[model samples]
Target: MVAKQYVPATGDIVWLTFSLQAGRKQAGRRPAIVLSPQSYNEKTGLALFCPITSKVKGYPFKVILPPSSRVTGAILSDHVRNLDWRVRRARFEMKAPRQSVAEVRAKIAVLLGSGMSSG
Candidate 1:
């Protein structure tokens, strides 16, 4: 039997593979938070994600995710990556609390230094 395929959604913790990266970029398979809507994930076969790290550094841009059944670590908001979430590359784990998701998104916005807005 094969592993089940799941479409990722915001707040979801998942294991996904990143292509070889250079200079502080994330590579290899690791846990990441899905920040994209499920509809977008399905349509594009991609999920915008922030890489999680156990190497907690208390950085201003990193958000610490307290221990939870879903995941436990710091999300590297500065090292966000949009990558493949297809079955072959990603496996859904669990969802973080809505508040945590919101916090993460907010940090990313600040990291970007511009409120992403459209008029």
Candidate 2:
């Protein structure tokens, strides 16, 4: 019996084998928050996500995630990337609140460093 594949939404937290070191290395599984829309994820089997880390590096792009049932960490917006489903290890039922998700999006906009227009 094959397990059902779950398409993660914009606020869902999931564990995935993320690429690190300038995309030259694949690291151990870690929690990440989905940043892309579910429609994109469903169509492409890929999504943009920001990593959750325990140690705060004080980066301007990092946003703090509120504690859920299991973990509390900062969303490293600088590390956000589009990842394929093959890298996904597990999905957590835990979802980031709407406010946190909005904060993460704002951080990502800042990280882009282009002063994206709100219009």
Best-performing candidate as measured by lDDT: 1
Scored against the true structure, residue 82 in model 2 reaches a CA lDDT of: 84
**Tens digits of lDDT, candidate 1, 23-90:** 76567788888888999999999888988887877588777886755688888877777776774377
What lDDT would each prediction earn against the true structure? 0.80, 0.78
lDDT of 1: 0.80
Q: Model 2, 1-119: lDDT tens per residue?
A: 99877888889988887655655433668888898888999899899888788887667777887655465878887777788855565576578878878988887666676866788
Model 2 ranges with Cα > 4 A deviation: 1-4, 20-26, 113-119
User: Where does the lowest 10-residue lDDT sum fall in candidate 2?
Assistant: 19-28
For TM-score, the strongest prediction is 1
Q: Pairs clashing in candidate 2? A: none
Clash counts per candidate, in order, are: 0, 0
Judge candidate 1 at residue 50 and give its lDDT.
89
Model 1, residue pairs in steric clash? none
